[model samples]
Target: MIIARILILLPLVSANKPQFPLGIAVYANPEFDICHRDMRAVMETRDLKFFNSVIDKTRIYSWPLKNFKSDIESLHNSPLFQLVRKMPKGAALHIHHKAMVNTDWLYLQTYRTNLYVCDKHNHLSLKFFKTPSNDCNWQALYERRRNPLVRQVLEDRIRRQMTMLTEIPDRSDTNVLWEKFQNIFTFLRSFLNYRPLAEDHFYQGLLELYEDNVMYVEVRSGLQKLYDLDGKIYTTTETVNILHDVVTRFKADHPDFIGAKIIYAKSRDMDHDELRSFLHETVELKKMFPGFIAGADLVGHEDAGYKLKDHSSLLLEVSNWTDFFFHAGETQNFLLQPTNLQIAIRHNAKRIGHAYSITKEPDTLRELKEKNIPVEVCPISNQVLGLVSNLRNHQAAILFALDIPVVISNDDPGLWGAKGLSDDFYMTLMSILPMNANLYSLKKIARNSIIYSTLSENEKAAALDSYEKRWQQFLINVTMPFCDYTQVMYSWLTLDRNTW
Candidate 1:
């Protein structure tokens, strides 16, 4: 009789245990639970197939273990990726403005007339001119693309230069990778600096995010001055107005779109006075465009640049004027004293970008949890930039395990041919989170993006309400009798077979 009582109590004890990683309120809903089970089964089957594949066997332990550039095409063909593409991702809080749209769209812009391209030591730079001048061997791209053979070869070369895609992603030297990465931005700056093209670029970027089911975004933009075809330069305010116009037009076309905000980002490589001037300008812009300018951030590779604490007084002073979404702890060097993570927390950063090394600092992690500061985790960016070899070993997995607030973002999706937040979200679900993580995990993460966003409380509430409704509809769609998972898989394969 005692043994029987113990067995019955054992089941009760198991039931009382908390869910791993974290628990979600929606876990109690029967419909949601059923949907989650179905989704989990699909995810597990994909994992099994991926792990048993011949390529996976020779290369890495798992699918995400491979370089993102090499694996991105295959991921696009995945049924799981398709499902993620259809889900309502709450917000993209850490995307770079210039790198938001894919290179394919940028390549199409080269077809415009009077566009000049200068090739120097195998590096390409583009600019617009009313009349061609002998500036750095400026050749008319219009004439270059006139030949079918030349157009094909030149397009391929330009696309390759514009992206970071490589079969052998450099793993040994991060400095080399960063050098190449920064160079791509430099090459793009000339091409995108044209006012008309900039407007189109911003609009296309929003469309890409919207099509990927991301409702809102906070773009980390440099707010650089733009020039017209006749070399008429527009002031910073003019540029901001242009961007605002693009967002307004986009939202009008897509009524469901919640719109975008700019986190005016300046490079950390600036001197003390330069940053102070930039901060003052940022404050003035925030005043000018109250609803559009969300905050300020210093973006660049952390280790090589001045630390956040280096400009403490200026940052502290500006903290009263505007909020901060500082990029901190992106480095792999943990032994550095008063790390960026600690400094960012000290400065009361609203959101931490790429806190990849946060796991190494227990005290800092505790402080982040206590302060409820969310870390904008970019999984594929970290992997591609040589911060971590495999997503399974990424520090974000630790953050998830500890229940620390995390918002998955795409730092520079366009640079790698990724469209939106879906790629990063897919990586988080497949590799960062535990295999047992269910739909509740995804829901909670999506919700957190809104909660920790720069949106006002009222705006956040409305966004969450909208998100909840859409999420429920998604659940219903996936669970309906006519929604055959096998058919979806086969269809994706057929559609993407050409690329494969």
Candidate 2:
């Protein structure tokens, strides 16, 4: 009788024990549970097939590996990767506006009449006008690319100058890689910082994101001004207007697509005065285009730049109205003490970008848990930028295990030859996400993106409703090959919810 009582109580004890922290439920209605499970079943079966074929045979040259080189090598041609491309990713919340598109396109843009290039200190720079002085060392790119061999070399140089292709950046010298990374932007500025090209580039970037099945995106633009070829400068207001127009046009063409927003990011290396000026100007811009500028962020190498604490006063000046999208804990140097992350939490950041070291500090981790701040996890960016070596051991899995909400993003995807968010999503599922993380985890991640976005309440409701319809369609499409009439009818009934 005592043994029977113990067995009965054992079930109760296990029930109270914490299961995996699944974060917030995607839906309040329990009827959606059946829909989620069926969707999960299809995705899990597909995942198993992918693993059994590709992961089990990594010795084969065509498998997708963790690092940038191996992954990029197989990414373009893989059938499984194509499936990832088709999957409906809800939102991409952490892309840099400038680095949204690849450099190859920028190289082609330089050919748009009379563009001069100079080779200074072995670094390529571009200018719109020709300089008569030989001392200027400016040569026309069009003239230089006339010869076949020279053209090949010139294009190759341009590609290398704008991408992180050669080096494998690790913790020992991330600064070196960062220097190269920043220089790429400087090199491409003349080509991309012009008005017409800027509009085209931004639109093309959105096209790529849309093609990858990403419905919504929030890009981090530094609110820099654009210039024309005739040295005519466009103000920040004009730039913002151009961005708005581009997104509006894209949405018009793709009616089913949700909208995009901008997070006006600024360099942390700026002095106090510059920070104050930026805030003032951004506030004015926000007044002009209320919905266009969603929030503000500090964008730079987290290790070398000033921590958020240094600019607290200036930051607090606009904290009441302007939401903070702090890029904190993106470094390995401060493992023992994550000052950046701690300051971000203190400031009550809406969302933390690349909180790579948050897991180290227990107090900060707990605070983040209680506050429910989502970490924008850029797994490929971390690997390529030298923050983490292997995705298999990335701290994101630990954060996820602890119920910390994470949204996978493609940071600087273009620089690394990643076409869209699909690359990051594929990498997350195959490498970073734990073995037990299933389609429901993916569903939650997608849901968290909208839940944490700067969109208004009504917009959120509309977006979620639209997403549900798309998800239902996606389920039918993905499971079509594996399902027969009975399974199809069951899925339809589950989606109909009223039947229950």
Best-performing candidate as measured by lDDT: 1
lDDT of 2 by residue, 1-500 (tens): 32122112221111122223556222223343323433344444223444444434353222323566555766655555665666678899999988998767766787787678888888888766634246568888889989887888888887788788755633336888789889988887776776787899999899889988888999999867887756678888988998999999999999977889999988999998988988888788888888888878888998785778888888888888778889999888674443889989888899999999888788999999899889999998888888776777789988877878788889899888887888888777667666544444465677678878888999888887777677667667665544565767675666653221
Candidate 2 residue 489 C-alpha distance from true site, Å: 6.2
Model 2, residue 227: distance off in Å is 1.2
Badly placed stretches (over 4 Å) of model 1 are 1-20, 23-26, 31-61, 133-135, 147-153, 482-500
Whole-model lDDT, candidate 2?
0.74
Q: Least lDDT summed over 10 consecutive residues: which range in candidate 2?
A: 6-15
Error in Å for residue 147 of model 1: 5.6
TM-score, one value per model: 0.87, 0.87
Per-residue lDDT of 93-151 in model 1, one digit per residue for the tens?
99998999898888889888779988889888898888766768888998888888878
Model 1 misses residue 402 by how many Å? 1.6
Estimate the TM-score for candidate 2. 0.87
Q: How many collisions per candidate?
A: 0, 0
